[model samples]
Target: MSSRRSGISEEEINELISKLQSLLPETRRRGSGRASASKLLKETCKYIQSLHQEVDDLSDRLSDLMSTMDNGSAQAEIVRSLLRSS
Candidate 1:
């Protein structure tokens, strides 16, 4: 099939766009086919960044909880060393 964007076939591009649209919230996605590729890409970037931030927050919370556990686990031991060294 002839490509509309050089190298990448138009079908492939459309498929990628559809996936991107699915990732975005309904409020952000322009369902009318009027959204540009750049706009879609920008939204996807923001969405990914937000997800990364969420993951980081959850990881920090998990670390804090693990370190506070009284089970004498490996993670608690590591945290104990850091606290004593301070």
Candidate 2:
């Protein structure tokens, strides 16, 4: 898939992998057993997909909030104009 504004950067992916490695048991960290390449790739893809969804959701929410604030401000201005006329 093409990279988007919400896409994870290499640095972020590396950080995530580092954190995951830290959480692994000492034996696993020492390479007694390792996750398969396919499994790791699948997990990473899932994580990135989740991040994209979260970013999109937050963006939509922020847009809605801004629209609400703008409407409120417009209404307040109308009310102030009416009070001045009275």
Please give, for residues 1-86, the per-residue lDDT of candidate 1 as tens digits: 46853798777888888777777885244565646788888977898899999999987996778757976688688876876796
Clashes of each: 0, 0
Candidate 1, 78: how far from true, in Å?
19
Query: What's model 2's lDDT at 63?
Result: 62
- The top-ranked prediction according to lDDT is 1
* Candidate 2 residue-wise lDDT at 85: 100
lDDT scores of the candidates, listed in order:
0.77, 0.63
Top candidate, metric TM-score: 1
TM-score (all chains, Cα) for each model: 0.64, 0.45
lDDT accuracy of residue 24 in candidate 2: 47
Model 2 lDDT per residue over 24-77, tens place: 444245673455445556666776788899999987985675566655597656
Collision pairs in model 2: none
